[model samples]
Target: MKSLRNLLLGAGILLLGSCNQAPVSAPAEPAPVDKAAIVLENIMTRASVRSFTAEPVSRETLQTIVRAGLQAPSAMNKQDWEVRVVDSQDKINAICDIMKKANPNAQDRFPDKNSFGNAAALIFIANEVSDQPGAFSAVDAALLAENIVLAAHAMDLGACIQAGPLRSMESAEAQAWLKSLGFSENYQPMLVIPIGHPDQEVTAGQRDASKAKFVE
Candidate 1:
């Protein structure tokens, strides 16, 4: 019995000696990402701004925003979009007048009361209306508009997507205005986006999972 016990203890010691451990692995570090760059997942999380400060947006910055807008995808790669940057105070006031006259009730609905109010610049998206089958140009123009808004927010600028300015003109008036503003007569205004420094901070709306549904 004593010999058997000693043999068992020796076997246990030998088993323990054979069970050696490998080296421990250190955790891998994550790669750094640019904080300012727009990520697709968070793109819709940004806010739309209407109010703006008296501070002006520089021409260089405006160009950057427009360039970003132009990067949006268009059907057939036509990229058939034209942008008009209205920086003149007089033209802005004129646009406001047109809005007021066109929509008499706009004063009550849009009480802030002006196109490009205190806005450093207004971005007008246009496309050749005759070139599309049915409002395709306008649809392309809208895509560009949304891109401009996202780019504006990413660049720390405030932007307001407005429908008032575009609705004020009839076909004739729109064509005339387009021609007068140096755009081809065939091009029609699709969106009027006002860009400037934000006077008040805008908080984005909370994500509503129910608002978006996926289908298999």
Candidate 2:
């Protein structure tokens, strides 16, 4: 009976000791994300790419980039624009041919030889050519184009904003290709962005600080 009492007392002492122990501390929270700096860095570091690897950009990624572009602010929120993403090698080749054909009559259109950067895809931003649009369509489309290139840069993809395509798109030889977009007689091409995995690393051009002045 005495031995049994001793064992019971030891067990009780152990239980009390266990209860007296300090509680476990909770885990530290993860660091808050500094998205502002990241965005600023992206803007500051983004450079226009001239060449691209043969690796094809997935349609999903293109869609995501275009979706990001759609977030741009529009005049009166008209958002009257259409995006055509061309990733097909065959179609892309055809378009390249068309670009060359259209520029043939021009005074100085890459006179030596033609080069299209061999990009994985071309994203054409077209704004509606409406007589009475509720707001400024060109400005809205331009804003969206800015959003697109920035988003592509953020995703590690490179893009070049080419206004040169505007002339090509308006050429007679481009009618067939434009018709294929199903936007015949209504939309006008504003900008075409070629995007892909960058093969060439271009340095950012120097900014004219004098152009930007401190206002009182």
Candidate 3:
């Protein structure tokens, strides 16, 4: 019986070894590293532009940016976010007027006048208060907003994220503006981002590896 057991164990190991040595399908070869580097370089070159052409971003591109923003990480996988896109010249100008009045010296302080421009469209990122705790909601909004910025950049579009305009008012007009856009009671405006093609060239900033901290 002991001999028989030893023989069975030996046979099992041999079978396992044979299986391990058998040809196994491998994953598809990845794209060239240089291709990836070029793609990243293109994305990095994208920058915020205060001046934009008169052209408007197509609905498709706008949708793509919103979809990307929606893909951002959320607490507990609960993605409770809303985006309000302002494209009409009237609406854009109205908001711009409000911003201008809110900060008379805005252009002087922020010479970029980056808050709003000829950029064909604007987007407001909001989060539902009930979806998270006080600060958590803002954090979620921020993550999603960054996604919008990066995605826009990837598409060769320019984006500027601003918190100033939205914070100015709990004014009835402001509430009405948001409510008109179908924002639920829980959705609070967090930030506004303007989108467009850059009129002036934007330079990419170098990445500093030293800023990253890693733990083994």
Highest-lDDT candidate: 2
RMSD of 2: 8.5
lDDT of 1 by residue, 1-216 (tens): 999999999999988877765556887788788765646634765687777777878889999989988988887877778999988777777656665566667543235636455687889887876733544676778889988988888788889777766666654644465566677667766778988887667788787789988888
Question: What is the lDDT of every predicted structure here?
Answer: 0.76, 0.83, 0.77
Better model by lDDT, 1 or 2? 2
Decoy 3 TM-score against native: 0.71
In order of listing, the candidates' clash counts read 0, 0, 0
Q: Which is the winner by TM-score between candidate 2 and candidate 3? A: 2
Clash-forming residue pairs, model 2: none
Q: Which pairs of residues collide in model 1?
A: none
Query: In candidate 1, residue 206 scores what lDDT?
Result: 81
Q: What is the C-alpha RMSD of each candidate to the true structure, in Å?
A: 15.3, 8.5, 15.3
Error of 2 at 169 (Å): 3.6
- The deviation in Å at residue 80 for candidate 2 is 1.4
lDDT of 2: 0.83
- Residue 193 accuracy (lDDT) in model 2: 89
- Give per-residue CA lDDT, model 3, range 60-125, as digits (tens): 999999999989998776677888998887777666666566666656333554347677898988
- The segments of candidate 3 whose C-alpha lies over 4 angstroms from its true place after superposition are 1-35, 108-115, 130-135, 170-172, 206-208
Clashing pairs in 3: none
